[model samples]
Target: MNVSTASARVPEGWREVNRAMWDERVPVHVAGSFYDLDGFRTRRDDLRDFEKAEVGDVTGKSLLHLQCHIGTDTLSWIHHGAARVVGLDFSAPAVEAARALAADLGHGPERAAFVTGDVYDAAETVPEPSYDIVYTGLGALCWLPDIRRWAETAASLVKPGGFLYLAEFHPFTEALDDATGTRIVRDYFSRGAQVWDEPGTYADQDAVTVNNRSVEWQHTLGDVVSALAAAGLRIEFLHEHDVSLFPRFDNFEVRDGYHRFPEDHPRIPLIYSLKAAKS
Candidate 1:
């Protein structure tokens, strides 16, 4: 929002514009069935199996989640045996919700904590200098414009022998047609701030809302991997999955606790996960 795009002059900063939209949607997301807050409180974890397998065990280890929206996934880490967990988000309302959820789950500050800050400032915003695991969940990277800055910030937060894990919607999906998602209509390597104005959040698209405009950027997998490797982290592995946690396309159907193209449709990588260790 800072830079003047050809289309519009958004005087508001990206953080301000995006955070406003997220802040307005925090309550809607929590109450909506998408998050399943009640089921989560009852000890049901929504973390995908692939994420658990790649991150391995967290027993007694410290973890930091950057851009950690409402901290649903952050609290889930504490339940999975993390010694302590810290969640950082740009939205004050999201952080408040996370703190309330932590309290509801009977976790004190030592065990569960949340901070309100920008992801680019994570190195200084987090409670500790470093953590055993620096995790970023799905849909996080697209919000960031500078991939290298984000990589450096996240890498700086990983302790020696620790790793930074990221699970995100594949940038490839962005290049496809929005409706059918089969034709490549957009530039694959385009790296610029994209402005979007939609009426509702992904959770409940039908629900009316204010603060509907948001700005985002696209960072390709190659760009992300190269940036992290340049930041002094050893790339462990990059795994692309055909499964999507949500209905990303009209043809997508639920299968094995995930959504994917139906039997008749060809599969494409809908998401990807990567692990880079700070050795």
Candidate 2:
């Protein structure tokens, strides 16, 4: 389905549908072990090696994390040396949970802040003057129907000389089937939104049984790069990785907190990250 079809289904439409779905998932995620709340309570870091090396030192920098669900990675930046961090999301429950989690973790407002707002409306909802770094977490880009608008919003939030960093599921990975994950089951260049009506989530497959319906769009690497360029950001580097942070496919084996395909399997890029500076 497309945005037009999604818009016709209900009042306030696709965004509303996604928001409600996430609101329902927040409680499950907080209590689930997948996010490892128990682990985060003792450890201030939640970021992986790739992010640390690519983004470099955030020490004393003001960072903005867009689509920061539950603030795990956002708070991780603080542990890495960011002076201040602002996390924004569309889900109110997620924002509330993130604030409570931060407080419980001894993070006061001085170190971290959480805002509930759509990424598309971030410019108005968030503070002005931009930030030293704008970070977008994984699995974030597919939720939105418009990448151009998303890129513009991201660029608008970055100060000149500052950069926007993104780590996302590759469009090639999205084309593979969700079960076996070996065969390509969807179109890689699809522009319209694909409707999903699955129960539970990637975090936990058997936690709940609600009909979690949502809409997702596929965005190509060209789409991402062009959008950033059109928004006046200079591309620095784009890298694709063979390993994924989560188990996206059945063939992946969990090791060292990342999922990897068997050595014999065909090598394909499952994740990608890019850094773009506002020049």
lDDT of 2 by residue, 105-143 (tens): 888987889999999999988765599999998999989
lDDT of 1 by residue, 1-279 (tens): 123232233235877898889999999999998898988899746678999999999999999999999888998888889999999999999999999989998999889989999999988888999999999999899887789999999999999999999999998997887667889987888877778778777899887888877888888999999999999999999999999877877777798888888878877899999999998
Collision pairs in model 1: none
Error of 2 at 118 (Å): 0.7
Candidate 1: which stretches are off by over 4 Å?
1-12
In candidate 2, position 226 carries an lDDT of 99
- Residue pairs with clashing backbones, model 2: none
Considering every candidate listed, which one attains the maximal TM-score? 1
